[model samples]
Target chain A: MSAAPPSPAPRAAVDGETSRRRGLGWLLLVPGMLWLAVFFLFPTIQLFFTSLYDPSGSYEQGYTMTWHVMNYVDAVTDTWNLFVRSFAYAGIATVVCLALSYPLAYAIAFKAGRWKNFLLVLVIAPFFTSFLLRTLAWRTILSDQGPVTSFLQTIAVLPDDGRLLATPVAVIAGLVYNFMPFMTLPLYASLDKVDHRLIEAAGDLYSSPIAGFRRVTFPLSLPGVVSGTLLTFIPACGDYINAELLGTPKQYMVGNRIQSAFLTEHNYPLAASLSLILMAVVVVMVVLYIRRAGTEDLV
Target chain B: MTGSLASRERATAAVPPPPARRPAGRWLADHLVLLLGILVLVYMFVPIGYIFALSFNQPSGRGATAEFESFTWSNWGSVCEPEGLCESLKLSFAVSLTATVLATLLGTLMAFALVRHSFRGRSASNLLIFLPMATPEVVMGSSLLAMFVSLGFDGVLGFVTIVIAHVMFCLSFVVVTVKARLVGMDARLEQAAMDLYANEWQTFRLVTLPLAMPGIVAAALLSFTLSFDDFIVTNFTAGQSVTFPLYVYGAKLKDFPPQLFVVGSAMFLVSFAVVIAAELWRRRRSTWSR
Candidate 1:
């Protein structure tokens, strides 16, 4: 490719063409950027502004922007338990998803020699069905008289009268089930990119297979682990569907609080404040995680 | 996808000692991960199997149960018997279609700009794209609703608001997917077109656009599914407008008909078939080209 003689004129011409193309790039970027600015960035700023509004106003009467930032204090104090529980549930679900997905992704990336695509399709096929319907199915499967509970009871895992429905266990289980694919796909993507020779080199260095996996493969797959956990944890924290469908009020997350504050209770300031807090925490966590993972180009 | 079993076996043959003297413990260790993977797959499908079985179940008087009662095809026959069910489904389809088209068109343009040209603030634009995907749906939904209310569009929250919200979230995925394709594209093709004296428009239309179509199509499909299956963001923004998920939520509170399961199962089957067909077509196309 570099065998041709270096020509100054053509090189200068190429530079001029690229610079001209740069001018046209803004035209192409404007449409999408403008849309995102109006709907995404602007709305986020609006949410922050809304968070500082007077909390005493009703939804119909409208909120007044009095710069009363105490709404954040009030919102946090009011739903502090729910906030903690939400992160706890999400964190546990993320860990569980990682544990379950790592092996499955590894199998597809390494061991599913001829059936890799078929196995990957199987992993994603269940997601084609409605997520809400799938969660609802969990409700039935974990109901008091369901097979899961009955089997648990038979094995003495649960007392005869103990039930799975309306429990934190059920809510967490729903979350793990729902976010499994999110974790698996990213892990598979990174694991599949791993060069087989690197692991072989580690093996030749007198490392056991497990040692090679830990020292070489696991480090290589960290990007996937980081992104997968981020993807799973962020959404899981804000998810109210599992809590609403599977668990009782006690299992309600920050999402449920935000939802009811906005829709059911009509407390705009509270909801807005809560939403802002969730966004801020997620952004901080994501930035810290990406920096620690040493991957700047997440997208 | 390319490595055959024989190649994999050969690859491992170079790594391991001869099988004649290999320890049984090492063999079990080698296969344990695959076994665990199969178990996880079965675990994922358990609820799906339950959902499929319940689709054929005769739930006692519209109250959905997990129990597999007598097998009946009534749910399949009258899938739309539930009031407002089909209406909700239609609303979801309409919203997903509109969101997909708008998001795909705008996102493809952004992808081309990011990949094919150099510009200041390129990294900043990339950050903006990642922000939406990173933000939780609840936050995105509430923030959009807050913006709308502040702008006095509170009462007008229905189809338009839902579509807007869907497009906002779907944009990031579209841009990322199409940008990947654009970035991985061969620049030599466009260079060759220019060498042949093809104008920029002609070159783009004939070479670049065609190469990016599969990515754009995949992104559109992904956006459609995300929009259709969305419940979290839609829930906050959709005022008095019930999508399929919202309808399902309502049914959960009241009585869930077996027909809901039928709809879900049918959706699964249709998507599965489409995916299979796409894979087969891709395989055929690659073979033909080769």
Candidate 2:
């Protein structure tokens, strides 16, 4: 792939061409960037501004520029528990995904050769179906008379009266199942890149297979671990669907709180404040992860 | 070289004291983890299998007992009825198709800019493109709603609103996917074309686009799947319009229709077929390359 390196003279010319191309590039990017800035980013900034000023119970009400920063305080105090629950569920789900996906990723990346693509496709295939549909399926499978519960009863794991639906466990299970592919794919990508010869070299140096894995394979795959965890944890923290579908009121996450605030409760300022806070949490975590992983390691 | 010779000698010497190994037992011990891994895969697939089974099960009109009963095609029949699943499926396909195409064109341009150009605020521009994807969907939806209302638009909240939302989110994936491919590609190919007197557009069309086709196809397919499967943002933006997933969700809560499973199973089947085809195409490409 690196057979022919370009000459320096041509490289300089190429660099000039690339710069010229970049000018043209801006022309192409402007339309899309303008669209996002207008529709997405501009509104987000407006949301922050709107949150600071109370809405006069009408969409047409103009905001008072006087910063009612108290909206942030009010939102936090009101929905503190929901924020805690969101992070708690996402945190647990992240750990569970790691525990399950690591071995499966290892199996696909290192063990399976001929069937590797088949197995990877199998992992991804369920995702093609709507995520909501999959969650709804879990609702059925965990319902009172569902086969899963009946089987559990036959094995004496639960009493006949025990219900699995509308529980935190079901919500977490739905989350872990839905996001497992995100965790596995990055792990597989990293694990697949680990040179087999390095493992052999470790073995030749009198390292046991376990020791070799710990020293070489594990460290190299840390990038994948970090990326996978970030991908799963961040999204899961803000997820509302699983909690709303599979869980009772007690399982409401920050997302549910935000939804209800805006849609059900019709408190736009509170919802806007909550949205800003959630975005801040996500931005901080991403910055922290990027710093820890080093910017170059992420891609 | 010295360590290799020494290890060879050690292996020859250490084998003298060993009992002859039983190959089958060693094989079993070595493969136990992999077998267990397959078991875990089966466990992960069980819910999907249960859904598939229930979709075909006859409706007994009773709670859960119907799942254990004799099989029937009635649920599927109901899903296929003129007033039912077909309408949702048509809307889903149309919206997903429109979103994918618009996103691909705009996203590919942004990707080209990011890869092939240098500009002021480039890093921040890249981050801005990615922020929507990283932001929570509910937040995105609510903010978009606010934007529409604040702009004096009646929150169009139908096909147009849903398509715009889908494109807004899916474009980031396209940019990321295509930019990764662009970074890996050789700049010399297009440079060589330019040196041969091809104009910029000609060079891109003849040399760059073909090389970027695989990434473009993957991005398009991914965006299609995402747009098709989206619910949260679509639910917020889709006021009166009923996409398939939204329809299923509404039905599940209101009537608990047994045929919802049939619709879900059909979706699963369609997605499975597409994925399998993609896998096969990829494999064929690799073999042809070899």
TM-scores of the models, in the order given: 0.92, 0.89
Q: State the lDDT at A149 in candidate 2.
A: 80
- lDDT computed for candidate 1: 0.87
Worst-scoring 10-residue span by lDDT in model 1 chain A: A1-10
Stretches of model 2 off by over 4 angstroms after superposition = A1-19, A55-66, A151-160, A295-299, B1-32, B62-70, B82-84, B191-202
Q: In candidate 1, what are the lDDT values of residues A103-157, reduced to their tens digit?
A: 9999999999978988988999899899998998898899998889999999999
lDDT of 1 by residue, B118-228 (tens): 677876788788889878899999889888877889789999999999999999899988987776778889889989999989999999899899999989998998999
* Model 2 per-residue lDDT at B148: 69
Candidate 1: clashing pairs of residues: none
> Which prediction has the highest lDDT against the true structure?
1
lDDT tens digits by residue: candidate 2, B1-290 = 45764775477556542333434443563486477668768867877887788777765564442254778878887776524567887899999999999999888988877776666767677778868866888888888877766676664678988898888988878887787777779888988998999987899789999999988987898899889988878877787789988887776655455666777677778878877888888789989999
Q: How far out, in Å, is residue A170 in model 2?
A: 1.0
Report the number of backbone clashes for model 1: 0
Compose the digit string of candidate 2's lDDT tens values, residues A206-230: 5545656777788889878987987
